[model samples]
Target: MIVRGKDITGPLRESADVCIIGSGCGGGASAKILAEAGKKVILLEEGGYFTSRDFDGTEGFAYQTMYQRRAGQSTEDLSVTVLQGRCVGGSTTVNWMTSLRTPEFTLDDWRHRFGIEGLSAKDLDPYFERVERYLNVKAEPDENHNPNNRIILDGARALGYSTKANGRNARGCVRSGACGLGCPFDAKLSVALTYVPDAVKSGATVYADCRAEKIEGSGKTKRVAGYVLDNERRTTKTDFVIEAPVVIVSASAIHSPVLLLKSGVCNSSRQLGKNLTFHLTTAVAGRFERIIYPSGGIPQSAMCDEFLNKNGDNGGFWVEAVPVYPALAALAFPGFGRAHRERMREFPHTGASITLVKEIDSVGRVTVNDHGRASISYDPGPKDIEYLKQGVAAAARIHFAAGAKEVMTLHARPTIIRSEGEIERKIRAASWERNSLALFSAHPLGTCRMGNDPQNSVVDPHCQTHDVPGLFVIDGSVTPTSLGVNPQITLLGIAEKSAEWLAENFAAVAR
Candidate 1:
C-alpha cells in the first residue's frame, strides 16, 4: 500500500523484511524485485507523491513541489547548480527520458581498474534488455525531431560529424517539451508510473514525504528512524521507526553519502563521502532568423558523440539540445537587466545546445553540514576545463553551420559570436573561473564507490557495505567511476543484479 505521510493522523511505525531508504531508479527497482521474491519490503521517500493530474506543466509548480531545494541547490561555493529530484519517482520523473546504457569503456574500467566483478557488458546485457523492454526505451522517429533537436542533427550532418537520435523512455509521448517539469500526460513512464506502482502491487509498502534520518544496526536487526514531513510547511510532523534485517540505501550520490555520514556507518574506508563526479554541463545558444519554438516539441531527441572519448583518452564531451523555458533561459542567458530582457524577447527565435563533459581528472566531495544537510564541493581539473572550452567552441561552430545569425555562450561576461571566425577567439577570451561561467549537473555520481579492497572502497562488488552487515548501497553512489552517458538504465541494471543476489541469499543475510 502507498501512503502519504502528510495524510497520516499521527506517528506511524512498521517493520518489514527489507527497508529501502529511497525510491528512485535504484530503490524502485529493488523494491519490485525483493517484493516479488516474497520478502516484505518497505520503501521510504523524502518527497511527496504526485501523478499526472498533479503535474501542472508550469515551472513554478514543478520546481516548488518536485525539485530538490526548489531547484536552487548548489555546491558549497555556489558555482555549479546541482539538479536532483526529491519526489517519489525521483529524477526519473524530472529527467528528459534520454535513456542510454553505460559506455562499454566505463564497464571495462570498473572491472579491470576497480576490480568490480560480475558486471561486464556481457553480464549486464540481459538486465539492460529487460529494463529497456519494460520501459519502452527506443529512439524517436526523425519526423519527431523538433527544430531545436534538429539543430544538432542537421548541423552535425553539415559538418560531417556523426549524430544519432536519442532513445527515450516515453511510450505515447505528445512532445510537450516539458519533460523537465514532470510529464503531465503520463506518456512518459517514469518509475513513479512503472516500478513504484508495480512494487506496491507486489505487496511492498511505500511511504512518501518520510525522510530516513539515521540507520542503526544491532546484531541481527537494523532500525531506521525518521520523521514524517508536513509537505506544505516543510516541518516535521511526527516521528516513526522501522526495524528490519536488511537495509538498502539507494539515495542519490549527494544524499546517500550524507545519510551514511550522519548515521556514522559504512565509513571504515574513509571513502564513504568521496570520489564525486558530475557530468559538468554548459550551453551555447544561437539566434536564428526563423522562429525555432524551442519549448514546444521533444526537448532532447538527438546528440552528437563525435567528440566523446576522442583519441581514446576517455575524456571529451557529448552535445545535446536543451529545452528553453522562461525562468531557466533568464538565468542561463548572459548579461544584466536590459540585455537579459532583450534576450528574453528573442527567446522564441533562439536555439540552445548543451555539452556534458565526462570527468576524468575532476573530483568532487559530498559531506554534511552543521544542520545535517548535504554540503557539496567540486574542483575541475585543468584538462577538464580545456575540454569545456573545446565543447563550447564546437557547439558554436555547429550553430553557425546550422545557419544561425548569432551565437552566445553562458559566460558571466558572455562571448558573442557573429560569424564562424569569431567562435574561437571569443571563446578563448572568456573566463573559465568558478563563477565566471554558468554550470549545471543533473548527473552526480561516484560517492560510496565499489571495489575489491575494503580499505579503499566503501562497498564490495555485490554492493554490500564492508563495514555494515546486511546493509547495501544500490544507487548512482555505488558507481566506481563516471558514466559517460545517462545512468538511469545502468542504475536499474545494477539494482536488478544486487537485488537478485539479496533475494537468493535472503535466509543467510537475514540471519
Candidate 2:
C-alpha cells in the first residue's frame, strides 16, 4: 500500500525481505518485479505520492512542490543546472517521456571498455520490449506532433539530416507539453501510474516522504535509517528504519553515491562518486515568422542522431527538440534585461532545441558538503568542447534551413546569429568555460559504475556491490558509461533484468 507521512506519527521501524530506495525508474522496476515474485518489498521515496488531481498546471507551483530544490539545483561551479524530480515517480513523472532505447553501439562500448557483460542491446532486447509493452511506448505519428516538435523534423529534413520520431512511453497523450512539471492528465504514463502501482498490487509497501538517511550497517549487513519529511510542515523530524536481507540503492547517480558515502556502507573501492556523466547539454532557440506554440504539444518529439556515433566508437552529439515554455525558455535562452524580455515576448513564434553532447572526456565527481548536500564538479575535455560548438552550429544551421528569422545561442558576445555563416565563426570564437552558456543536465549517471575490476567499479555485472554482498545499486549510477540518449528506458531495462535475476537466485543466496 502507498503509505504517506499522515499514515504514521513520530518515529517508526520496519523490516522487509528487500528494501528499495528512491521509487524512480530503477527502484520502481525492481520493486514491481521482486514483489511479484512474492518478496516483501519496502519502497522508500523521499518525495511524496501525488496524483493528477494534485497537479495545478502552474510551473512555479509545480517546481516548488515537485522538483528538486524547486528545480534550481546546480553544480558546485554552477556551470550546469540540474533538474531532478522529487516525487513518488521520481523522474518518470517529470521526464519528457521520450523513450529511446540504449544505442547498440553504446552497449557494445560498455561491454568491451567497462567489462560489463550481459548488458548488450541484444541481451536487453526482451526487457526493453517488455517495458515498451507495459508503458504503451509508441512513436508519435507525423501528424500528431505539435508545431514545436515539427520544427525539428522540418529543419532536419531541409538539411538532409536523418531524423526519427521519438518514441514516448504513454498512451493517448494529450500533448499538453507539461511533462516537465508532471503529467497532469495521466496521458503520460509515469512509473507511479504503472510499475509503482503494480508493485502496490503485489503487496509491496511504498513509503513516501520518507527520505533514506543511509544504509546503516557496514559490509554485508542491510540496515537502513532515515527520516520522514513532511512537506506541509517543512520538517523532517520523524525517524524510520528498515532492515532487510537485500538493500537496493536506486537513488539517482548524484544522490546515491552521497548516500553511500555518508552511511559508510561500502567505500572500500572509493569509486563511489567518480566518473559522473551528464550527456552535457545546451540549447538554441530559433525565431520563425509563423507562430509556433512550442509548448502546446508533446516536447522532444524528434531527434537528429545523424552526427552521433559517426566516429564508429559511439561518441558524438545530437540535436533534439526541447519542449519550451515561457519560464523555462526564458531561463535556457541566454540573455538579460531587455534582450531576454523581448525574446520571451516572441514565445509563440520560437522553435527551440538542445544539443546534447555524449560527454566522456571531461569526467565529473559528486561529493557531499558539510551538511551532506551534494556538490557536483565537472570540467569539459578539450575535444568535447569542440564537439559542443559543432553541435550548436549544426542546430543553428537546421533552424536556418527551416526558415528561422534569427537564432540565439548560449554564447556570451555573439549570442544571436542571423546568417548561417556566422553560426560556426561566432561559436568558435566563444570561450570554452564552465557555465559559458546556460547548461542543463537531466541525466546524471555513472557515479557508482559497474565493472569486472574491483579497483575501478562499485558494482559487479550482477549489480551487487563488490565489497558489500547484500548491497545493490540498480540505477543510472551503475551504468559503466554515458548513454547518448534519454536514460529512463536504459535504467528501467537494467533494473528489470537485475530484479529477474535476483528473484531466481534469492533463495540460494539467502541460504
- Which candidate has the top score in TM-score? 1
- For model 1, what is the error of residue 425's alpha carbon versus the real structure, in angstroms, after optimal superposition? 1.1
Pairs that collide in candidate 2 are none
Score residue 128 of candidate 2 by CA lDDT: 98
Candidate 1 positional error at 172, Å: 0.9
What digit string (tens of lDDT, one per residue) describes model 1 on residues 318-359? 899999999999988888888889989998899999999988
Deviation of model 1 at 119, angstroms: 1.2
* Runs of candidate 2 exceeding 4 Å displacement: 218-221, 412-414
Q: lDDT (0-100) at residue 22 of candidate 2?
A: 92
Task: Please report how far candidate 1 places residue 373 from its true position, in Å.
Answer: 0.6
Question: What C-alpha lDDT does candidate 1 achieve relative to the native structure?
Answer: 0.92
Give Cα distance to truth, residue 133, candidate 2, Å: 0.5
Clashes of each: 0, 0
For model 2 the local lDDT of residue 166 reads: 83
